[model samples]
Target: MAATLRDVTTYDLKLAAPLAAGFVLFFVTPLVILLALSFQTDPQGGHYGLTQYVNFLGDSFSLGVLGSTLWLGVKVTVLTLLLGYPVAWLHQRSPGWARGLIMLLVLLPLLTSVVVRTFAWVVILGRQGIVNATLSWIGLIDTPLKLLYTEGGVVVALAQVQMPLMVLPIITALSRIDPNFADASSVLGAGHWRTFRKVILPLSLPGIVAGCLLTYAAAITAFITQSLIGGGQMLFMPMYIYQQASTLQNWPFAAAISIVFLVSVLVVVSIFNALGRLSRGYANA
Candidate 1:
């Protein structure tokens, strides 16, 4: 037994070796470098201090950018959840062929490049694009409403782009739910809605929480979509970081912002996880 256990442990270590090495090499090393850079002086050489952090936290413009970025993340997460849950439930309940088709449609966006998808939104939301033309033709409006270069456009594009991520987790959670629970609830005089509310919804909390975290993270870090759709009118943290690093050549400040962005994501995700745990505890109780 001891020999077998030792062999199993060895096998597990071997299995994890490549992944561990890759993580340290690609993720941890770069992050350590970024953290170090965040503390250093810029190329012009002022002083190695908290000047960047102070400037970022103290500036009203920076604060506004951070607030808007966080707000956009929340909006995108909520919108994705609202749209994804129904689609996931339907997909899970679908027949094999229909399920396959739905899954294909859901995953199709992931297969396409994000730049391509954002550009597609650009075309769709543009004044001369399909939405405006259709609306104008239908007499909904005489002039093209401003969709491009707006938060609405960003949210719409992001929700569509991240829908698959939200739906996939939800479908996984829904699939894991036993049909027997619903049947038992029905036998106990519960309707479909009640059964879903008491049984299915609680059970699916894990997936919903996971999807929210993923969607929020993606939305917050989104650069290309914000850049293209927002047209410099809207500001997000990632775009700010890019502008500082690329255009302004302020690497230290950019790194500082990046660190803040990382910390903010971690903090928000932690809060969400805690909320999910509390909800689960309440449900279980």
Candidate 2:
């Protein structure tokens, strides 16, 4: 006799217990300890107060570092979206064989270490690098431009490094869109730009939001790329926290800074979540 069956994974809460326990033990427990430590006035960990937090928030330099890091994320996210959208759209529009080649190129960056990728940017942006050489060949300037160790350099490098994060989601979203919708818009006498602005863009809002969130988070916290491209002079939150914890040995202040950064990131994530909800409605309309 044949037996009837159904998917058990959908309803099996018990299957997730071990994962939940692991998360609690590894993540939640450490986060709680860190939060508690952030309240301590002493690095030694017993004297509890808001001194560390007050020091951070009340200081202008510290606030500037936080603001600059967030701004850096925004710049990187915007550049990535602008560059990635075209690549994704191209991938979507390409023929079957071309799609495979485009996808390979997109996935190629992920195969290597981030450090390696970042160092490649370092070479490319250096005084005698390809950019300067190209500019010289074109007579754009008599001298090599200072590209490395600048904010612009950091933004460009981060965008290249984090591009796939922005592109892949957009490709997925674009693929889901019905081709007939575009054709219908054209039939309704909408020009290409009008169809894209009205139909394609609205439908792709969810993917754009997802891509932006991922790119923003990665770009801001990219310690390796930031350190290599931005140099010691450009101080962001990751470097600030590292200096406090490792160099100065001020664990309490580091913990406090970390908590504040975490809260700020959570706020950004909440905004993205709200955008995602709005995008769904916008897409429907």
Highest TM-score scorer: 2
For lDDT, the strongest prediction is 2
Quantify all predictions' global Cα lDDT against the true fold.
0.90, 0.96
The TM-scores, one per candidate, come to: 0.93, 0.96
Stretches > 4 Å off in candidate 2: 1-10
Q: Provide the lDDT at 116 for model 2.
A: 100
Candidate 1 TM-score over all chains jointly: 0.93
Q: Over the stretch 40-155, how does candidate 1's per-residue lDDT look in tens digits?
A: 76647556888889989999999899989999999999999999999999998899999999999999999999999999999999999999999999999998999999999999
Candidate 2, residue 255: lDDT: 96
For model 1, the local distance difference test gives 0.90
Weakest 10 consecutive residues of candidate 1 by summed lDDT: 1-10
Please provide, for model 2 over 117-158, each residue's C-alpha lDDT reduced to its tens digit, 9 standing for 90 to 100.
999999999999999999999999899999999999999999
